[model samples]
Target: MSSYEENYLARRPEYLCHMCGKCCRVVTTSIPYKELKKRSQKGEKGASDFLSLFEPYESIEVARKVDAAVVDNIINRLIDDGNYNEEEITFYCCKYLGDDNLCSRYHTRLTLCRHCPSSPWSIVPPGCGFEGWLFWQREQEKQKVRLLKEELIELELLKHRTSDSQMLDKIDSVQSKIRKNINLYKRYGSENW
Candidate 1:
């Protein structure tokens, strides 16, 4: 589970979604849907889990017109990262969304759908109530990344002071370790963090 999911569940486990169905209308992934399907066919766990619950939008332009937030926030962010290829970015919607932006399976929604848009960087609708929450989540992640970088600098100094090769090697390994934590927020532009 993500730290956000764990912490939030510990504090507020009861699911309290606004039910805008905008999250249902706008789903995306770093990889193209075709590749996702291919990965699913190859028994990739993440691809299988996501595809089993969501279905791709039949018309990209139509989906864009229906809710430009996904296009603006998600697609544009991918473009800025130099990963722009409209065909490579697919939008999706939860198959369970019913009329008037309600979840058809409100009582037994998938856990993933329950905590959908698990982070602030997720492409939610413009007016979705989680806007402030998302901002706070991003700030938390940014701060964590900054702290990791700080520890990395200390590790760099420790490496120079150590004569033991094993200890020096541990410092290198820890740098990689810290980077793994930092990369979790790289999608939110944590490079500067």
Candidate 2:
């Protein structure tokens, strides 16, 4: 992980949670339900662990009935990101969340549960404490990618100045690695940066 990512994990503000239970009451995954089940059957720990704790609501409307604001917040965010797909969206609720919004299995919850809002892109409820932090993390990531792109441009310039086969090969390898890092963020539109 980059230093930015390492710092993000290290500085996560778990204390900032409002304990409203909105996150536990309404949730969704990037992967659809059927794909998650397939990955679970394939012995993927993340898929199985998430499935073990969260049960899918019958439909989006059902999830809305549970918490209209949270549901609409997630839906609007997805739409704004151009990732809205009704067929792919499946809301879920954690079975361990008590009526009071506390985790009944807090002591024995899985790592997945313990790491709620794990990523900068994690879809959290409106008014979530992680909102500002996640946004900062995302900006950090974009800045990193932009720096890598600048490095790539300088590397390209170096290629024109070199005729040594060995040096050219090494530069190509470095460029490949840098490109792989940039490609990882293409879903977030890193190419534009």
Which candidate leads in TM-score?
Answer: 2
Q: In candidate 1, what are the lDDT values of residues 6-40, reduced to their tens digit? A: 76644432344576788777878888888888999
Q: Compared to the true structure, candidate 1 yields what TM-score?
A: 0.75
lDDT of 2 at 30: 82
TM-score of each: 0.75, 0.88
Residue 137's lDDT in candidate 1 = 70
Q: How big is the positional error of residue 17 in model 1, measured in Å on the Cα after superposition?
A: 3.7
Model 2 misplaced regions, further than 4 Å = 1-7
The runs of at least 3 residues in candidate 1 whose Cα sits more than 4 Å from the true structure, single-residue gaps closed, are 1-4, 8-16, 43-45, 155-176, 183-188
RMSD list, candidates in order: 3.4, 2.5
Output the worst ten-in-a-row residue range by lDDT, candidate 2. 1-10
User: RMSD of model 2, in Å?
Assistant: 2.5
